[model samples]
Target: MLNKDCHHNCNQGNCPFAQDSNNANRYVCLKCGVEREINRYPSGFGSIVMLLLSLFIASQLLINWEKQDNQPQSEPAISSLR
Candidate 1:
């Protein structure tokens, strides 16, 4: 059972009454009792933000790796026989 906060009339037998499953966006219709997936954020802004954030983190890691690879290594100390 979801929050049941929806308060819209079913003009065409499509009023969302309950969720189809737990942690799912699909909802059951009130008039016809049909399960339908709902996209509350159809713009997909969250996905875009996550993608950008991932790309930024990946780029930072790559830059750090390249810097480490380009650094010059120290020469080993040699001991001379007395």
Candidate 2:
């Protein structure tokens, strides 16, 4: 069985895995010696994705604005001369 799942059959108040004294992000199973790391903050991958998404949206808005600005205005119709 996986060390992470070691507590599956453990009692409600009892678990084999405990936090490592040196690292708060690590959890070790006393029975199997398996370790896992916890991530409190997001990774750089998420930041990169958000940055790209925002840039895409900003570029689209700028393109639409420029199109509106470049469109020609309607001219008044000239009356027919007698």
Best TM-score among the predictions, by candidate number: 2
For residue 40, model 1's alpha carbon misses the true position, in angstroms, by: 6.5
lDDT of 2 by residue, 1-82 (tens): 3545554544343447889899887887675666667865658867999999999999999999999999998999999999
lDDT of each: 0.72, 0.75
lDDT of 1 at 61: 100
Model 2 alpha-carbon miss at residue 28, Å: 3.8
Residue pairs of candidate 1 with colliding backbone atoms: none
lDDT tens digits by residue: candidate 1, 1-82: 3224445556545565687667478777665555666776755888898999999999999999999999999999998999
Once fitted onto the true fold, the runs of candidate 1 whose alpha carbons sit more than 4 angstroms away are 1-40, 79-82
Q: Model 1 compared with the native: what TM-score?
A: 0.45
Every model's TM-score: 0.45, 0.51
